[model samples]
Target chain A: METSAAGLEKAIKAIKIGLSLPEQDHLHRELEELLGWLEPLLAFNTGETEPLLFGHEAVNVLREDHPQEGRLAELQEAAPNFAGGFYLVPKIMD
Target chain B: MELRKTTVRQAADAVWKGEITAHQLIEKTLKNCSVLNEGLNIFTYLAGIDAVEQAKAVDQKIKNGEKPPLAGIPVAVKDDLCYGVLPTGLGSPAFSEFISPVTAAAVERLMEAGAVVIGKTNLDDMGQGSTTLSSPNGPTVNPWLAGRTAGSAGAAAVATGVCMLAVESDSGGALRQGASHCGVAGLRPTTGRVSRHGLNAHCSSFARVGITAFSGEDISEVLDLISGFDERDAATAVCREGISEIIKAPGSKDITIGYPVTAFDYLEPELREIFEQARERFAEGGYRIEEVDLGLLREGLLAYYVIAMAEAFSNHARFDGIRFGKTAEADSLEEMYEQSRAEILGREARRRSIFGAFLLSKDNYGRYYRQALKIWEMVRQEFETVFERCDLLMLPAARSLPRSLEGESGFLEGWSEDLYCAPVSLSGMPALTIPAGQVDQLPVGMQLVGPPFSEKMLLAVGSASGSTGK
Candidate 1:
């Protein structure tokens, strides 16, 4: 259950959460505590049980293919910046 | 003395009879809200002007001799809900300015039924914690006790008489635990029983839009209006007949209520005594009380955290800072995503998101995520077996009464406190928490859990307890 510093850094990077050195130390400690909390699940023999992806009894629910207008204008208005109904972000290409 | 003190049904009756105008009720509710917010911090956003206008419209309808079900009752929704008029912060700084263009289906149904939303109340940021502590505005203080966590701002608003009804959500017992702490009635319907169309997703599969109100009558009435199929939420099934009929009819006299003694080992002496007294009442009233074994359910705490964290990380990936809210000033897109999430997302959220990422990453996916899902299936099956012996299971809503908010470390402690209620969520069953009685001045509550889509039976049991109202 002990999460190494390297493993913690990989988790933060993979999750795209930027943590400062101090925050990283705090979170690393917290993660180790949380992993310790999760120890009970590791002891169970779960090989026979089927993994439940959905909690409900329903299978895949399909609707008819239909084109419908959405609230694009309202969504654009709420965004920080948008042009031609597309969300604006910082430059990704050089 | 305040009109806001009336329950939803009582106020709606008055509005229909012209005893009070909707506008007058909203004004009184706003006044009470101002007073309550001074010490309790009950609301994050008060719908002052819009509420008045909405009330006036209800008054106009009343003048024309039409009656709506909720008719001018003041209501508060949890801030995490996606209502368009007020900006949703989800208790996080990242969403402080986020305007939800779409309204939730349940909220829309309430408005259509003539309920006026007075404000949005605070919750743990993004509903991550059971306590209402993670909000940037700070935690909601319990009105019943000074130092104890007040539950959610929505629960506080109802208990403090600022709003007649409060709309709260539950993934892992947020609404029920809040109700238990605050001495109110909260009902979490079976998952997909109430449409999840307008709710902000945390653990999408586990989360359900529920409500907190003064009485089981109020909660059941709201459930009747909102619990049905929605085209927007494909998971919603066509509701079975007999909900209204069942609520009207008396619950079966020969009912067998299950008590899971093993699951409630953490309960304190005072709360345990109160629970025992209530159990004695049921036994004296000719009801069979069975002690059911919670085999797989004993591991509910670990399974809930694992599944919820994984789903939350996936659901929250939409908060890229480019879509809405304040974005970080950065040179590149990658830096923007990282800096924005890091800067705005709070400690609890960041911890969970990373934990989720770690659980789902590479070999860890099969090791943790899959294993938890299997345990989830086992928990559901165990509940199915338990239900075969009893009509419904009666349990405490919380392990202990509300704890002090002045503590140094509340994050880890809060997660552990959800043990009593998380098992219900893991099984996707219906549960209603009603204030059973009090231990001294503070209130203690008990939860009644039923099989899936058995809301009417649960509400009947709640009503029979005679604790849903003052």
Candidate 2:
């Protein structure tokens, strides 16, 4: 679900090239860490007296936890780009 | 009359008085839109069905003798801020083809108040630029001077005749500075002055949806209609409701005003002189003026760009190959991101992402982002401190005069001029820009920023200054 330093660097390098070098690995790593801490918080919220970021809101669970029917069939039927239950795309090389 | 030149209030009165039918208003409005929009490039998309349906409804209401606050008034909104009917793109090539499924709360409220939706306007690619030049379609030209900067020059030109009332959002000086350069009235109300639910995110801390109109009263009148608690937007502060009515302060007498001696140093010589004369004019009007020492905001644009861009890079991630915009054209999962990134981003959007990443990096966040935050805090503190000593603060709208087509502020220059205006916007204070008359036949506007949620107070002051004449 998350990237390590080398993996992030690889992704960053790839991203930079695709971005036409808008940024380099060094900058992405810095943003990655900050973003890792902030992704959930990047939205506007007012749960607190002051402006509450999305990350600050307490997570709530369903009052009555129960299994519901899944959208598996509908979701699967809609995927023209899928292969092996995953979205297919061109692979990149180092 | 087509009622094109009338203020929102004036147009609404004509409809209420049975002088103009809503359909006629819409017909004339579309004609104006087609005629004027070619040169200015203001609206991104005109809501043909929605506009007509809304107009027909307003006409029926009139037939029933019903009256609404914005009855039959045609208003235009910026593209990124959602209105439910049109495809909302924040000037990015990514979702340039996508339409919004839900309507923004702000748009919902304005429509409920009887405001006819004309269309969605243009903006900086990703709402990242201030001058409206960064748009992928083309910079929104000032209506008065062809090819003039809209955010900077269009603010005044829009007043001259682009749209009757324009809804422009501000992350930095996007509203007031544009309004200032355009020679119209722009107001960035305090945080929560209006709901940000349907707004495309820039930097939540620094961003706001502001209004532009010739009359300060029009901006505040619309502000009153849309400002309130929205159950959908958690950031919608419930502590304060909208200003009950525009404050009736005609002009200040014995009111102490702060003029930054040091900050004024940032002004180009011509801007400095124009500001000095406006300060003198205010003093002559029986108001007290004081030279408040605001530690000059040296690199505020850099700080603003870093802070806002970081927020945008993350916000824009949602457009990744799936939710909106173009899907990646690669064979595998990892390769998809690369292909999509190349196709989606514009020049400035890419530049903003790089700058945001660099400054928000661990090594630089403290040096750049945190330091910028500290400087901003200092500026806000100084504004508060000075306001305690003075009721209002006077300053110039921009650093240089209206830029010629040959002379653009460019990316760096554009980022820098926001220094003076960004502090006011970020602090979420009420800031207003009013024309101080043309200098060498080019317009120069002065700004009077006030305390939070005190737009009524600022509008009253700006109206007094603006009322002195063209």
Candidate 3:
């Protein structure tokens, strides 16, 4: 079944992507094709089987909650803007 | 001396015996990089001077009468692995300049064991595809056949003798597929067998740092150096010792190997011939082969793709140009994110994220995402049952010889290349691919899969099958 153009537009909005109308149209076609490929999964009745969230069998590892020295310098370098050991971003209060 | 062709064990022995200096080996490897990169385009970033310095350090250690496990061996790493000195591109334009401030635990162990980091090899952008064609850098060409896809850039680097060992990752058979295409051996250890602390998150649960080399013994040497528990990566298994010791002479035990027709139905004529010959050889060697029904395991590709796309959607949400990676100028925060991602991510990455969002959307979550996970669990359970009756499972690596690079658009869909290996990944089991033999001059590989923590037994079986020529 073809994905409705309106449905794809809703999906694009929900996903928070930036695309022109032409690009959206192109993506609509691709999404429809991909959905068709994914159609087989919907047909299988999974019943009460639980999902395997993590593939490995290891137990959850816990560490202390105390603050420790982190890679602050590296984080600052990767940040878009930093000054006086603080991150700068568009004003949220305004 | 064909220094480039020197195996991991041979190089260490030579360096220890003072027959060759690590500096000379690094020089030869750098020269190989220059001559081969034109045809194969293997590495995304070469550690030219930095690699030499590391090699010099190894040579100094050798002169002092110390021998490291991988002494002075040149190794290639996938671009996504975090190396503080190397600029990690992740094969995407977005991360072209992203230098990791930290190094992977596995890589740290390798360096400690005396392996020299020669270069960072290319990969599909964010490891989204099997064919290594999605890179903003040109697709890696197969060294064996010019203009054919180098299934994994690291695989090509190892095959062409540019690097003696390669560190790579596999989500959906990228490691095995590339190894098969390039006529080398690659092993994807159990999901948590190696640390993912320094590895980029792409299909996080399914992705693992895999080892690649020309032979099984070389792969085993590297695997022993890297596999262990890490406090940083919470999912790592408890430290297992003596993994390298298991690569001993192939045992004489009569092994039972299970073959499923569902997996073999897609094999091309040439690969079928190779598969038959391998089976005959195993039989002559006194191993028993039993054919089994794959059942739900046949749906492995669909389940793997759905889960991978959904995870990718969440994993890539961090790259909005706000924190890291290349950012585009825009007025609003959302616009900055949208524009930067659209400009930076490749077509496959973008499509996957969108499809992933669609799968997890309110109306589709139960129908798509949950269903795929259920199937994932079912496939795992089915394999658990199969393993009970057989010592190992055998299947063809690629359905056919790799497709030509020119005859196709760079985009790969349906993921047919991963048909054989993804099921093992989904179950988080270990699979070792051996270059079983060649078909029509193209290499063909057979995978040996066992239950979790079966690396030693799997390698022993592979070694015994004459896959490593040990």
lDDT of 2 by residue, A8-74 (tens): 4544443342643334444454446544433322231212322212311212322356787865554
Q: State candidate 1's DockQ.
A: 0.65
For each candidate, the DockQ is 0.65, 0.11, 0.54
TM-score to true structure, per model: 0.96, 0.83, 0.94
- On residues A2-29, what C-alpha lDDT tens digit does candidate 1 reach at each position? 3467677888888787777998998788
Over B159-234, each residue of candidate 3 has an lDDT whose tens digit, in order, gives 8877878888888888988888888888998867789989987798799998988887787777767877787887
The TM-score of candidate 1 is 0.96
Could you give the candidate ranking by DockQ, starting with the highest? 1, 3, 2
Question: Model 2 chain B, poorest ten-residue lDDT window?
Answer: B239-248
lDDT score of residue B279 within candidate 1: 84
Candidates in order have lDDT scores of 0.81, 0.66, 0.79
Q: Which residue ranges in model 2 land beyond 4 Å of their true spot?
A: A1-17, A21-94, B2-5, B152-157, B160-162, B240-248, B407-410, B467-470
Please give the lDDT score for candidate 3: 0.79
Predict model 2's lDDT versus the native. Answer: 0.66
Model 2 residue B64 lDDT score: 87
In candidate 1 chain B, what residue range of length 10 has the lowest lDDT sum? B241-250
Kindly provide the TM-score of model 3 when superposed on the true structure, using C-alpha atoms.
0.94
Please name the candidate that would achieve the greatest TM-score relative to the true structure.
Answer: 1
